[model samples]
Target: MRLDKYLKVSRLIKRRTLAKQIADKGRIEVNDRTAKSATEVKVGDQITIHYGDRTVRIKVLALNLIAKKNEAQDLYQRLD
Candidate 1:
């Protein structure tokens, strides 16, 4: 799935446009490299998102086109 879409569907960024903007500005990284909004996200891929002075890292556990709010957390696993 596209990185932006994955972020939204997984409830990471809350909105697709915001995710796209974040990705475009290089706030998002895949496997330690800067990632764009259209970047393909696959299972087991590590994703790091920069948020001000803090960073959030996660590993893609699954990809789904749509997911319920209750199930969104299943899409990725938080990393140290």
Candidate 2:
């Protein structure tokens, strides 16, 4: 799955557009390397996102096309 879509689907960023913008700006990383919006996300990959005043790290647990709000958290496991 695309990095941006994974973020939204996993409820990390709340919106795909915002995730895309952040990824484009080089604020996101996958497996310790800078990642683009279209970067492929795979299970077990670590994703790190730099927010304004903090950072979030998570490990991809699964990849699905859609997830309900209540089930979104199951898609990734927070690492920080």
Candidate 3:
């Protein structure tokens, strides 16, 4: 799944467009490397998102095209 899409589907960013904007600013990373909005996300990949003075880290657990609110948290495991 695309990084941006995964973020939205997982409810991490709340919206796909916001995910793209954040990625475009170079505020996101995958597996320790800076990632673009279109970067491919795979299971077990570590993702870091920088937001203001805070940062969120998570590992990809699964990928789904559509995730229900209750299932969004299951798509990724928080690492921080």
Candidate 4:
């Protein structure tokens, strides 16, 4: 899946447009390298998102086109 769509579908960024904007601004990274909004993301890929002074890192566990609210968190695994 595209990085922006994955982010929204996984409920990471809440909205696809926001996710796209974030990715375009170079606030998102994959495997420690800057990632664009259209970057392909797959299972086991490491994603890091910068939010101000805080950073969120996660490993893609699964990819789904649709997921229930309670199941959204299952898409990725948080990493230190």
Q: Specify the highest-TM-score model's number.
A: 3
For model 1, residues 1-80, the per-residue Cα lDDT tens digits are 99999999999999999999999999999999999999999999999999999999999999999999999999999996
**Candidate whose lDDT is highest:** 3
The CA lDDT at 32 in model 2 is: 99
What TM value does model 1 have?
0.98
Clashing pairs in 1: none
Give residue 12's lDDT in candidate 3 (0 to 100).
Answer: 97
The C-alpha stretches of model 4 lying farther than 4 A from their native spots are none
Q: List runs of model 1 lying over 4 Å from the truth.
A: none
lDDT of 2: 0.96
Candidate 4, 77: how far from true, in Å? 0.4
Instruction: Report the Cα RMSD per candidate.
Output: 0.5, 0.5, 0.4, 0.6
Query: Would you estimate the TM-scores of all the predictions?
Result: 0.98, 0.97, 0.98, 0.97
Model 4 score (lDDT): 0.96
The candidate 3 region of ten consecutive residues with least summed lDDT is 71-80
lDDT per residue (tens digit) for residues 9-69 in model 2: 9989989999999999999999999999999999999999999899999999999999999
- lDDT scores in order: 0.97, 0.96, 0.98, 0.96
| Candidate 3 residue lDDT tens string, 1-80 | 99999999999999999999999999999999999999999999999999999999999999999999999999999999
In model 1, the number of clashes is: 0
Model 3, position 67: C-alpha lDDT score: 97
